[model samples]
Target: MDVTGKVAVVTGAGRGIGHGIAMKLAQNGAHVVVADIVEENAREIAREVESTGKTSMACFLDVTDRQSVESMGESVINQFGQIDILVNNAGVIGAAGWEKRETASEADWDITFLVNVKGIGTVTDTISPHMKERRYGKIVNIASVAARKGTATSTPYGASKAGVINFTQSTALELAPFNINVNAVCPGLLWTDMWERIAVRFRSKDDYPDELTPREVFDRFVKARTPLGREQTPEDIGNATVFLASDAAENITGQALNICGGYMMN
Candidate 1:
């Protein structure tokens, strides 16, 4: 999968899955723009990409803010000339402390939708026009397995990802005539701050094992539920993302590809 000279904008590229995706794209010869709300983290990741002898730039982006997203698109266009791929990886599971729907406040639901759902639309809307004019683009949205299976405790998070899947299909249909391919990547369990926070919530459950640590609980859950018997990695997600963004997956669009190691068959 060669993406030489392509320019890709990856939101939330400061850490975790987004960072991994940015690095993978850079390694594959794409000039990556690492966008994140945290300026320092974005800069650090951009530096890491540059260290690989690939071109990269850091942009301060708040995905929830439409203006900020638009600014990022404009900045990337100015710096890179054109945008060939857009990876919508910016998302949230809400704050770790509030897990259950009963305990989750209205603010929690609002923020979750704003960041995970609307944020994708915000960034894509800002950049897709460029692709449309050029008649070329690849968009990989970072959805979750939760989108397919609902969670008792994290209802809002699941709902938000579900919205991503639906949005991907709709966007793919609309963009297809222009030769833009839109797809979703559903990642399983990965050891990131998001999962670390989720582990904390699991440990609070009454049925949680007495001897197991939060991370142990996470590992155990993955081992039992996933047929692969292990946790997925950021690199795994990144590789899938790069493939989707590359010419290798040119014929694929509006599809949800799960990287959950058999946790989800669909």
Candidate 2:
């Protein structure tokens, strides 16, 4: 899996899975653009990428804000000339620990969709036309295994991911004729800030109990749900992402590849 001399723009790349993806791409020879809402994080990641002997730049991107997204998009195009690979990794699982399942507010739903769903479209719109002009591009959307099925825990999250899968398929078709491939990666359990929040929600349940710490709750879920009995890491997701963005996956598009440890298969 190589992306030598290519240009990749990764959103939410300041940390976690996004950081991993940026590093992997740079390690594989792609000049990376570390775009994140947090300018400091983006700058830090960009420096990290540069330290690996690859050229990189930092861009501030708020996926929910068109102006912010557009500004970053323009900056990347101006600096790199073109974006050969685009990874839509910016997303949110908006829910409060206090909010009950049946009582999920419209505010939560709106924010989740705005970032997880519409955000992808906005970023793609800004970047894809350039891809079409060049008739070459690779688009990867970071979805979740939750998209494969519904979860009583976070209704909006699962639904937003499901929407991501659908968007991947639809955009794949639209961009295929232009020689651009679009795919989705449905990552399994990866311990991140988002998962920490999920763990907090789990503790609120009757089964988790007060004695069970967040890590313990997360471990219990990972052991029960993952057939391989191993937690998925940012590096794992990064590997898959680099593969999809590389020429090895030129023919693959409009598909959601599951990165879970056999926890989700469809």
Candidate 3:
């Protein structure tokens, strides 16, 4: 998985899984562009990557905003000459308290789709042309296990990830002719900010344990539900991503690999 000298762009890389992916790519010798909605976070991650003796640049990106995404792509191409890999990790769980479908509002649904599903399209649409012209590229989309099953508490989020899976297949088929691979990674229980919000929801339930903290609930869930008997880490997701983005996975495309601790095997 030697990605040395390759230029990679990771969205939503300020923190959490995206941050892990960016760091992993850098550690593997790829020049990483840490793009985030928060300029501070992007710069922070870029600095972290630079500290490891790897090249990096921070770019402010609003995935839902077409112009903003396009600008980031153009800037990266202008600076790096080409983008070898794209990791679409930017997404949202929607407005707090609207996780359940019955209580979910149209606004929540719209925002979730805009960021999770449509945002990937926008960024890929902006960068794929460059890859097409160069006849080489790797795209990794961050999906979720919920995408494969219906969730009572996370309907909209699940649907949005489902869209990501389908979009990955579509793009993989279309991009295959150009020698590009498109794939999706469905991660299980990682304690990201997104999961923190879910922890809040769990704490609010009457059945929630009295002595357990929000994180404890996650630990319990992992212990009881995950066959692997542990929660997945951001580094786990990052390793899978680097493999998918490397030449090692050249024959793999239109596939959704689960990094869910065997939580949702299919």
Candidate 4:
């Protein structure tokens, strides 16, 4: 994958999978723009991008807010002159704590979809016009294996990711006419802050093994669910995102590629 000299904007690029994507894109020769809800984190990642000899700018962004999305989009254009690639990586899994007998509340579902699904639309609405004008762009949405199948434990998150995959395809078809490739990457398992929450939640279950700590809980699930018997990394997701954004994938769109170490097939 080659994105040399391209200007790329990554939402939630401060840490975790988004951080990995920004760094990888820079390493691959793209000038990266780090956009995150956390200003300090975004700035830190932007400095790292610059340290890599790639141009960068940090923007405070809340993807759910149209104004925030518009502001970040404008800043990137003003600083980099163009946005060749956009990674829709900002998302939420909703509030974490729930007893085994309990289920996700309506409010949790609302907030989850607001950030994961509507947020994508907000940011894309801000950037797609520029892409159409140039007739060139690459859009990658960060989805998850949860989209492929639903679990009662995280119905909100899974449903939101499923929306992401569907939205990815719809946007791909629409943007293809303008030579913009839109795709989604379904990351299986990564031990980010989000995963920490997941592990903690699992450990709190009444039936869950009492001997297993949060990390152990995570490890057990990884061993059982991952056919590769290894945990997925942020870099793994980054690699897939970079490829989908590269010229080599110019002809590839409307596809949701799983980067889960064979954790979820087809």
Candidate 5:
């Protein structure tokens, strides 16, 4: 597939890693559909894409909503004439204490599955028909290292991401016949608003020990954990996604590439 002339849909493109991926794709000459639950951020992202001289459309999308996912898919097809790439990047961090197992509620579990796992399933399924018609597609699901091991206290998040990995493999097998490559990118610690929030949640508000802000602390944590001695930036994940979406990764399907700065070598 020639990415330069292709149309790509990216969920959660409001900010952070999703925004980074959208920007990279646009920079590489792909028309982008920046979908996000956060309306303002989504618009901002769309504008940013356009600023780079690429076509971009912003849409309010709640991935967990079947209607929303289907609508967005239709919009992409209507606007661009065909769908070439789909990036499932929208997800949520379950309410605090969701990983306590016994304390985790059914509602929390359902939300995690709904947004983190099923959301991707919904979007991909809706777009599959278009890809099948064209006999070409590239899907990059944003998973996390949490799926590979036990998160400190984010079990639901971890489990949902694990589901993402398994689902990616399953989808790849099903889509390969149509020449679509379905894969997942499991990002490790990074400097993003989500990471800052997680850091704040882990630290005591009064005495967090570190003098750094929550975002800084999150970066420090990644540096401490990874052999690379630094956190993986959104740009890092963006580059990986571009490679996966390009013909360079045509032979790479049903795979989960860890962009975790060597944090998880397996």
Candidate 6:
């Protein structure tokens, strides 16, 4: 687990799981590049990393835009010399609560695919050249359980994540000869901003126990579904990320690891 001097680029690392991953990598002595669409949040995490006595840089990145992703990669290369790890953690929960595929408009599908699926392609493609040249890299993609288990109202999100898993497999196969390991981490519901938004959908309409906040309700749902009897946290995801990014997982690639507390046994 010693990652001293290793450079890591974590996308959408402003808050939640991405932020936790970046912080954990930094804590482990990696020179972390925190990339986010929100520049301010990225800078905030960079500051936090510095406070922890580690090297970090904040970059404004739009993973869906090829130019932006390339420019961010350039910036990291200029500052850090090389990229050793890339974490595709930036994603969206496209059209939450609208289960009916027939009800989802064309625009909804486009936006979801652009950000969740194509964005991953853009960033990974931009960084692949660098990784290939180095002949060593570790890639960790953030997929979701919805990708494996199709959920109601999750068509766009699920489809995009399923794409991520396949993309990881394909990319891993291609990068293996170059000594790069590509894998994915599938996370179940954690207490992130996305969940907060999802919670709102049930707030006014659903009749539940009076003692529960929307978050508590969501927690109860997970506890009932997950055999682990508890909800996941950003830290749980982060720890898995750090391990996957480290040499400890060097032999593991093209595989999707579920951090769902056995919510979906496969």
- The sequence of per-residue lDDT tens digits that candidate 2 reaches over residues 1-266 is 98999999999999989999999999999999999988999999999999999999999999999999899989998898999999999877884543334456887898899999999999999999999999999999999999998876588889999999999999999999999999999999999888887787788576688689888999998998899999999989999999999999998999999999999889
Off by over 4 Å in 3: 96-102
RMSD of each: 1.4, 1.4, 1.5, 1.6, 2.6, 2.4
Once fitted onto the true fold, the runs of candidate 5 whose alpha carbons sit more than 4 angstroms away are 96-103, 205-212
Name the 10 consecutive residues with the lowest summed lDDT in model 4.
94-103
Task: List per-prediction Cα lDDT, in the order shown.
Answer: 0.91, 0.91, 0.91, 0.90, 0.87, 0.86
In Å, residue 37's CA in model 6 sits off its true spot by 0.7
TM-scores of the candidates in the order shown? 0.97, 0.96, 0.96, 0.96, 0.93, 0.93
Residues 26-142 of candidate 4: C-alpha lDDT, one tens digit per residue: 999999999999999999999999999999999999998898899888888888789999999998887544333257877778889999999999999899999999999999999
Encode model 3's per-residue lDDT on 1-266: one tens digit a residue: 77889999999999999999998898888999999999999999999999989999999999999999989998998899999999999989876565333467888899899999999999999999999999999999999998988875467889999999999999999999999999999999899888877776676466567577878877876787699898988899999999999999999999999999888997
Candidate 3, residue 147: how far the Cα is off, in Å: 0.7
lDDT of 6 by residue, 27-47 (tens): 888989999999999999999
By summed lDDT, the worst window of 10 consecutive residues in model 2 runs over 95-104
* lDDT over C-alpha atoms for residue 41 of model 4: 98
lDDT of 1 by residue, 1-266 (tens): 79999999999999999999999998899999999999999999999999989999999999999889889988998888899999999988885457543466777788899999999998999999999999999999999999998775488899999999999999999999999999999999998988877777787566566577878879878987899898999899999999999999999999999999899988
Worst 10 residues of 5 by lDDT: 95-104
TM-score of 1: 0.97
Q: Tell me the RMSD of model 5 versus the true structure.
A: 2.6
lDDT of 1 at 30: 94
